[model samples]
Target: MKERVQKALDGIADLVWPRICAVGACSRAVDRPGRHICSGCYSTLPFYAPGGACRICGAPVAAKVSHLFTCETCTAAPPCYERTCSVLAYEGVAEELVKAFKYNRATWLAEDFAELAEGAVRAELDSHSVDVVVPVPLHPNRQRQRGYNQSALVARSLARRLNRRMDESSLVRIRDTPKQSLLGGSERRKNLKGAFSVVRPAFVRGRAILLLDDVTTTGSTLAAAAEPLRAAGAAHIWCATIARAASTS
Candidate 1:
């Protein structure tokens, strides 16, 4: 049949062609099987130093506090989320990865981001026994415009990897706020006030929740999103992002 011939052609074409790296701006072929990024590009991606990161925001701590000390901003005014873990500093190839995943609708990159997030959050997850995995919700308008929620994609992958329940219905965004990156920190917080609410309080009430996102600029959005979860009697809130814009210590 014609269908069988087409299938055979497709398979032969795949075997003959080299797989290109998925990281945008990289032209290299994938170096390893079952991977999208070439090893060379992967090595170039910015990574956090892994030690002495702030427990509150995952920012690099100047002095080695071993997770005991707080960063200037976090100590001055703590966020609703109890812990934070960002696997990479948002620069270089990491920034490219974020843009590709977030703007280019690269859903496969979600799997890579999830793997990075798992390495960071595994220690906490093992100790805390997370009850649920929640992705920061996008406004209905934005979701419709994009045809999918990036956070939901990353969170769904994360939950599956963690073997925890993923709940998209429990949290809802009531307002379609302006992009967080366009405003100052204060403006970002104000822009997000009353923007999120819990429609299904029963799901989060008294449960430890892990929040996932691709990149965090100021973390104002995450803090705002956690307010509703806190009010709903969630016992703990933790955040894990693919990258943070701040410099590593």
Candidate 2:
């Protein structure tokens, strides 16, 4: 009865306060509670199973191996990060939303994206024990140009929802590397090689860190960041991204 009354009060508060629409103020009415996105747009967002993904790389897999989402490539050659988790496949509306967030500076849309990312993080929390959330760093030059890092926004949202510590200062990007999307796998690896270094080793030492990024194409950038964390004595590192491009090869 007490819980029911509290829920009613919450509903009343929401009605009075009213959430601002995420798609911008056309002022369309939103029926769903506790969501900034309208019901229509929320339904349009893709959701993939957290299970049945490659444990090591977070790619979609045909079967469940001993490692969560370990596909054939990951089985043959392990990635630098121990594992990865992601919410949506990299295609369709997911790709568009991410692009808008990164390039257009759709800061308001982050609320909706964060909700989705937090759901993914929460699903994996029990299975994979995460001690800290670290956003993949951007080079100071690029970050200055972009004005914001989308990965950091996602990380901050996940951290708030999970009640975990976030270390935006731990990893530093030492060089402004070329975009990984434009390069082939080998070139991507070379582009990001030695690009990241640990700034505060003591904070990460003996801790299980959860690295957050917006997307993973070849995962070379993630591996580059993970290498420094590993050297700094991080006990374990897991990665999570909003999207992953399905490998054609």
Models, CA RMSD each: 4.7, 4.6
Winning candidate number (TM-score): 1
Error of 1 at 86 (Å): 0.2
Q: Residues 158-204, candidate 2: write the lDDT tens digits.
A: 78777888899999999998877778878888888889999899998
Off by over 4 Å in 1: 1-17, 63-67, 124-128, 247-249
Q: Model 1: clashing residue pairs?
A: none
Clashes of 1: 0
User: Native-vs-model 1 lDDT?
Assistant: 0.81
Per-residue lDDT tens digits for candidate 1, residues 91-155, read 88788777877788777677677777777789554424788899999999999988888888878
Give the 10-residue window scoring lowest on summed lDDT in candidate 2: 61-70
> Alpha-carbon error at 133 in model 2, in Å?
0.6
